[model samples]
Target: MKTEAQFENADVNMARRSFLHYAGAGMAALSVLSAASCKKDHSKPQMTTGIDIGATGDLAILNYAYALEQLEAAFYINVAAHMYTGASDDEIALLTDIRDHEVAHREFFKAALGTHAIQALTPNFSSINFSSRASVLGAAKAFEDTGVSAYNGAGYLLKSADYLLLAGKIVSVEARHASYIRDLISPSSFADSTVIDSNGMDKPQSIAQVLAIANGYLTTKVSAINYGYKAY
Candidate 1:
């Protein structure tokens, strides 16, 4: 596979291969992120405020992941705060854990991007019944599953072996999170064919398609120009 790096002609990111395992585990604990002063500078054309995805590359790819993390973090955090009715204690605990992970992911990109990090995204959760535990978990499962597939689909696009490996590491966690939520929705729902293809591979969507599907659920339209994703 001719993987593309996350930035313009950046190195293949082979240098980090030796410690990629270490890097992935530490992804959640990343502090001192670039989010220091960088935030949503101004309102953009889309209902959601985000940076322009400049183009394909490592940084851009990170930004893309950051945006999604922001979305998930925000969603889960909100769910934790309001909490859906009929949610069990175990369900609450799992959702809280998912929230923490997303926060860590969001912060990781912020710290890594420094001045280049994008702004916070406002989610449109109109479609979600925050009052229903079943509805909430189902939607969370979809988002998490979609997130894993998104990263998996994009991983091959990253030429930097290090970034590709990093993506793999993160997506695996996302898959776990997705499975946890799915099982909560219904037993044996985690590995269902609705998400997996005949080849047993996870199905993925283009970012545009993902966002389009997500648009109905979110009130804001998060753009990816900052990450430099050309509409395919």
Candidate 2:
């Protein structure tokens, strides 16, 4: 016959063994789950060769703008570093201001996007001769005109009222830049019939149209397909 104390000891030992068994099983299950999760993560697709700006959402629009700003900022930075010869004092001052504005716009978008901002793009200005006044101003005019048209076309796509307001402000400034550059290229051509319609409305281009022109000057090809915008 077993003593009472011995019986109690046997019960305690069985209980301890059972607890350890369940604990070990739980740990093994957790390990299996962790492994499965990691495998799923690894199997996910990565960003492809071209820059995918992403589809659907306010973020996509923001990223689109961010990419353009990056391009403009890079161009202005390069031009400011080595200004064209025979540039007037007024031209230099205007270009400097434009550079600062573009830099500020780039930084603003980056800060707003935080972790979602696209990578800095590499601009191909090989076609532009920075030493020549005509080439430099011509390039600037193209960029500003494109920027304004881009904003105008994309403004309706924004979901947030605040974002629309902010875009309006920026586009107005872009228009100013475009006007200044246009006047520099040809006297009194700022609001000419070429850029504005007979009704006096600024012309707008779709994302595809804008990106097609922009890609010619950018090493990184921007793809708006992910954002549901048609590819050029």
Candidate 3:
């Protein structure tokens, strides 16, 4: 049988391989977005106290996703910097992989958005107790769940089929992250009925709903006013 340390190393290796595969796919997809964007207006959104994700069609949705990715990335970066007490080697490896993935997702959106990308927002993790395992995993579960829902809800708002395709790809990854985090919280609870409905589908949340929950963790609020979404 493989030793615990061997398992940890294996998991970390797998995660790095996955990240490389994802990065290659992401770059290909971004190239498509770049070429497609050239034909359209590439104006930047107006800046305000809080980040305005713009009222424009696809760009608005992209910025919206970017904002959420930024929050998740920051949260995990903090978690990895100081892991909770008593965290096992397996947990550390898994969480580190998650952090790398979230960071990749964040940069992907930023690059895809290019000039239209929203500025990076400061994260507010004051409510989280990173020193406790329960607190850290609980917060991770919430972020992953919210991210999956946000992508599902906003996919339809994208005007370009290419953009929608990209969103679909990203959301699928987010769902995997959600499942992993959920299982970490409670074994075999990854697809609980609370998030998975009677129809056996993952739940989706509106941009307004997502931002309302997300902004609480962000020092800089985000708005998709053009989509008529005002964070509550």
Candidate 4:
């Protein structure tokens, strides 16, 4: 028969294991709760300074992408809220879907970047006549095309393979948005020579090039001085 001391030691070990198992589970639950809280909390400190997407590194690239996503999300949200005159039911549904996707993209980067994420940007759409279908779709085309090119151009700058993979996934979605917008404006022009070269490859715009175009629609500016981009 086992001694009483041995029995007690066995009982202590079993109790310790049980405690650890529950503790591990608790930590996992806490992690999920923390992520949810981060996503739900939208009130971030207001920033008055222009956005410097960092000098160089994965964080800079991620921030650059984040800034673009923020602009696109804001634009799409407004478009959905005050849908253009003559917008078909199908058009509203599709535009709303685009808005949701952009919001998800924005939130994903915000969560992934955590403490390093840039503050929300304020977009200026005074030039866009939201009530007109031509104006709304035209702006959408510009935003979507710029987003696709921005991702393509910046993909090579990411040092992390994981980040690169994520960029590729996002750019593909942006491409789809670009194509859809193109078709809406002009049927069968989705993959025209403008986006697809004779070699059948999509064109990519450098950070400087993209920011120059994007800044036209934003009150805040985005810059990548560290990436040898200046005068934007």
Q: How much lDDT does each candidate structure score?
A: 0.67, 0.76, 0.80, 0.77
Q: Cα RMSD (Å) per model?
A: 11.2, 22.4, 5.7, 16.4
Residue 165 C-alpha lDDT in model 3: 73
lDDT tens digits, residue span 205-230, model 1:
77776665555555545566444443
Q: Estimate, for each residue in 1-232, the C-alpha lDDT of model 3 and write its tens digit.
A: 4543454355445545555455555446656765676687756645454778876667778888989988987888778778899999998888878877777777777766778788989889999998999999899999999999898888878766767776788889889989988888889999999899899998999999999999899888887765577765
Best by TM-score: 3
Worst 10 residues of 2 by lDDT: 21-30
RMSD of 3: 5.7
Tens digit of per-residue lDDT, candidate 2, span 29-116: 3334334544553333345557867664566787788889888877877677688999889987888778767766776666566565
Off by over 4 Å in 2: 1-48
Instruction: Give the winner by TM-score: 1 or 2.
Output: 2
Better of 1 and 2 by lDDT: 2
TM-scores of the candidates in the order shown: 0.74, 0.79, 0.82, 0.78
Write the residue-wise lDDT of candidate 4 on 123-210 in tens digits: 8999999899999999999999889989988899876666777788778989999999999999999999888888899999999899
**Candidate 4: lDDT of 121?**
85
Q: Rank the candidates by TM-score, best first.
A: 3, 2, 4, 1
lDDT of 1 at 61: 70
Error of 2 at 145 (Å): 0.6
- Candidate 1 has what TM-score? 0.74
